[model samples]
Target: MKKRIYKDIKIRKLFKRYEIRRRLLLGLINDLSIPLEKRMEFVSQLNRLPRNASKVRTLNRCVLTGRSKSVYRFCKVSRLALRDLGSQGLIPGLSKKSW
Candidate 1:
């Protein structure tokens, strides 16, 4: 059925998005030097049940820099930026909630 096929496609996309988020969040937490437990908590809070394109773009901007040529480029930028922020202790805590 066409509807079943569409549903399957949607589910696959959702799984892929979750995989991306997991990878990105793990990288972020590692760069920030947060404990694994805390990282998991942050990821749980940040994860969206349904991905939104606008939200993803906004998060990408926050985590990365440089012109968006491709996903690999973005990943590089994000890793570098995260290291810089970590070294500077710029990563915020709960009290500074408004980012």
Candidate 2:
């Protein structure tokens, strides 16, 4: 688990460092006003960036237990923790529904 967290942190740091440049390159690549040659250059630069810098490489982890599976994006918590909190009425506007 710690190894997973460390890997995620490393990826996140790389992503942060390259995020602005990546966005700029992507924008340049997609801009129709730019010359095709310039756009191709930008595409090559983007491709040269480390693959771990991509957002797709980041994994969501639970806030409470650091579990990677069944995470709730809105709350940043694992499903198990969310369910427990909901059952305890600790989270407002969230409740367990009964059929």
Candidate 3:
């Protein structure tokens, strides 16, 4: 799990470095005005980037427990951790609602 987080962070850093280029290539690849051969070249260049650098490759982990599943992106935490913190009143503006 730790290794996964480390790898995710590393890939994220690499992605940041190539982000602008990736977006530009992606845009060019989709542009109809670009020649088919040039578009193919852009596609190949995009594919040459490390697979891990793609945003889809990164797994979201809980900020408190480092759990990789059931993460709430808005809160940046796992449901379990969020529930625990809310119950404890440690998470501001969050609480356990009772019927």
Tell me, by lDDT, which candidate is best: 2
Please say which candidate is ahead in TM-score: 2 or 3: 3
Task: Report lDDT per candidate.
Answer: 0.51, 0.91, 0.86
Q: Against the true structure, whose TM-score is highest?
A: 3
How many collisions per candidate?
0, 0, 0
Candidates in descending TM-score order:
3, 2, 1
lDDT of 1 at 42: 67
- What is the TM-score of each predicted model, taking all chains together? 0.31, 0.80, 0.87
Could you tell me how far off, in angstroms, the CA of residue 25 lies in candidate 1 after the best superposition?
A: 2.9
In model 1, pairs of residues that clash are none
Query: Candidate 3 lDDT, tens digit per residue, 1-99?
Result: 777778778888887888888899899999999899999999999999877777787788887788989999998999999988888899888867871
What is residue 30's positional error in candidate 3, in angstroms? 1.0
The better-scoring model by lDDT among 2 and 3 is 2
In model 1, the runs with Cα more than 4 Å from the true position are: 26-33, 51-99
Task: Give me the overall lDDT of model 1.
Answer: 0.51
Q: Could you arrange the candidates by lDDT from highest to lowest?
A: 2, 3, 1
Residue runs of model 2 more than 4 Å from their true location after superposition: 85-99
Model 1: per-residue Cα lDDT over 1-99, one tens digit each: 455445444555665667666667657766667777887776775564455322342322222443233323434445556556656667564132233
